[model samples]
Target: MTVQDIRAFNRFYTNVIGALDHRRHLHAPYTLTEARVLYELAHSPRTDAADLRGELSLDSGYLSRILTRFEQDGLVERAPSAQDPRRRRITLTAQGRETAALLAERSDQAVGSLLSAVPAADRARLAEAMRTIREILSAGRPPRGEDIVLREPVAGDLGWIVQRNAALYAAEFGWNTDYEGLVARIVADFAEDHDPHLERVWIAELDGRPVGCVMCVRDEAPATARLRLLLVEPDARGLGAGDRLIGAVVDFARGVGYRDLVLWTNDVLAAARRLYQRHGFVLTAEKPHRSFGKHLTGQDWRLNLTDAQQ
Candidate 1:
């Protein structure tokens, strides 16, 4: 609680930010602060100027100057707010949105690069450390820990599962739509014909938003279950969601007379591999293959439920 400790942490985090932000031309077309404003405007359309100021905690005069610059550049347009004639509304033009999207892509690339240096085993600790900092320092109440719930997939979750898998892989690994096609096929097959007794999906919700999902289904081999498509968003990571989803799958498999649980994952997914290892899964086999535009080693991991019970 001492000021010195907080100042030291601030310096440490500043270095981390510099590493991520100092990548090639992060602030070329826009300053870091201006890029942040563009990001906010991109996500929240028809927003009041004053509200934007409050949301970013920017000085009103400083924000007005930036908006003026953006207007001069034809990046955004301002109008009187419909809710309050006295207030001003801000909207990003098509050009502005394009700029914002470019900035977002650059940001994602920079983050992906920074993360590549961190070993997979250390990523969960890093994510947890960052989440703790954000939770403790943010102005509002931190996201509710008790609000997390796991439920069966509903009408739209299948689509969500496919889309999120595709988007996450694309952003993090530069994977192509071929991966999306594979996930779509798996989901479509599940939808077409899956036994209720031997197949199930769990969607992890935080604050009522789906942030993670996994599916357990009967394997081709008798008395076996396959775990597939497990994913947790960055925000939901380090919050026990992945662990919860996998635990649910294991429990259900063991409950329904399954002798073994098996999963296939690429070696690049080291964090997930670690999680599977912690749950007593053994790496049975691996082989190199070209997949999703990368040369990767595909692995088969298995957990023996009968052994687990003993």
Candidate 2:
């Protein structure tokens, strides 16, 4: 549909639904948005939230708050996705399923009531019109903003970092619990005790949810800081999230008066290497080692703070 066509349809549909207001007509507890979520859960076999947000085109933070409320009310349970542990799976409880059924039945009745007034032949036309709209517009995800945000970790953000790091690496690189344990230690150390001024984490928020994260923490070497746990979700890549995260880490390291910023990564992470080089980090040394259930070349990259004028 053209822009004008969509606008016209939206206006007409709003008026139609406004008269048949679901809240009043359905006489149910769930809001429209809540009903929409329940409907998705009831219908779709896929359970992970990363795809859910994409399918629904809802704001990540807003969806998160909704899910949190659902959890509190025992309407939904969230766990790691079996297909990809990096993504979270959302499931409805028995009570939740009952509620979903009620919502579904009411929704069907509401639509049925609306359709009762129209001729049977026109109902076929209406169904076809809806299909045409979906066929045209449903293939795309929402357009992303040019702006990506970097902010401090929130209540669940730290644990998210560990889970993502562990699960993502294992899925992407065949790493094992050994790597997970390492990440657990790093996250534990960061959370248990740290100098807030000298050590910091940046959660890269895109579309109102975290898509990437990086951390700057005090290194064993004097006056040096380590850049650690740099990761961006696969779907969120190529949108400059990695660059932004690296930039944030560099800025934080420099701001804290660290003379040098350093990081270690495997040679296999060519894209990450490119980002590091783009940010003026130089490869100082590399060594091959067997770790994470694989033999890999570990590369140390460093940036001298004085030369980093930008």
Candidate 3:
């Protein structure tokens, strides 16, 4: 949609639901921008201002002004980062937290009240459509919302990947304890000694949120690499995340002079198989494997890394 079309829709929505007016009144004490800063600080306390600046995509002077006003109003506090003396970490004060909570409650009520008229089934469809629209709009777009970035996994991203993967596998494949243990071991090994030269992890990010990840390990043989632990969040399945992850691993292997790449996966992983095949990997071996709660066939795939891959 064009800008004009979006404006027209906004106008229709505001007039019909009185949303815009209600929001203005409810947030009279603080401008939307200031309130957003408060909300971000409330959720992610002690965030560095530089990080916020990048997340919100605000000019340094403009952000400083907002923060200055907030500080004068006794709504937030700023402290020097212990790790980085130059960075100022911002956090909400008690008053700021309370105000943010009230704002959130009011906002939720406002949205819920507006949506209540829609039937449950229709609401689900609406929600799905909205999610699809958001994904389309946000493709390749940096998240510039509320001075806080929702991010994907990065090279050093920790915590959320482990938790999200465990939950995701449990929901998707009925994968349980064994899968979790395997993931735990991989994470532990990476944490203990991540050799950037020999191996690396790649993550897909949305506004900084870690949504997908893959690890590539160099093999003992002179020009070989092993791909492992590839995963993409269910919410972030589309937008070619899996493809990008595999490409990153392949590119990394090639950069390090690997002449071939290999991976092992279960037969049930149809999407992954397609991605592997798209990247020039061919299934060279298959065998029935009784493990991880199911009797399934495992496929070992290998790619001849041509000059481009090398």
The digit string of per-residue lDDT tens for model 2 on 111-178 reads: 77888999998977877777566555746554353435566676789999999999899999999888
lDDT of 3 by residue, 1-310 (tens): 6899989977997685455435546565777677677766654322689977876778999899989988998877787865587999676665765687677666666677778889888987887777676767667564432312222233347555677777887788887778777778877887788665557666666533567778888666677899988888766776677876786677556545678899999999999999999888999999998876778899999988774421
Better of 1 and 3 by lDDT: 1
- Give the clashing pairs for model 2: none
Pick by TM-score: 2 or 3, better one: 2
User: RMSD, model 3, all Cα superposed?
Assistant: 14.3
Model 3, global lDDT: 0.71
Worst 10 residues of 3 by lDDT: 145-154
Sort all candidates by lDDT, best to worst. 1, 2, 3
Cα deviation in Å at residue 238, candidate 3?
A: 1.8
TM-score for every candidate vs. truth? Answer: 0.55, 0.55, 0.51
> lDDT of each model, Cα atoms only?
0.82, 0.79, 0.71
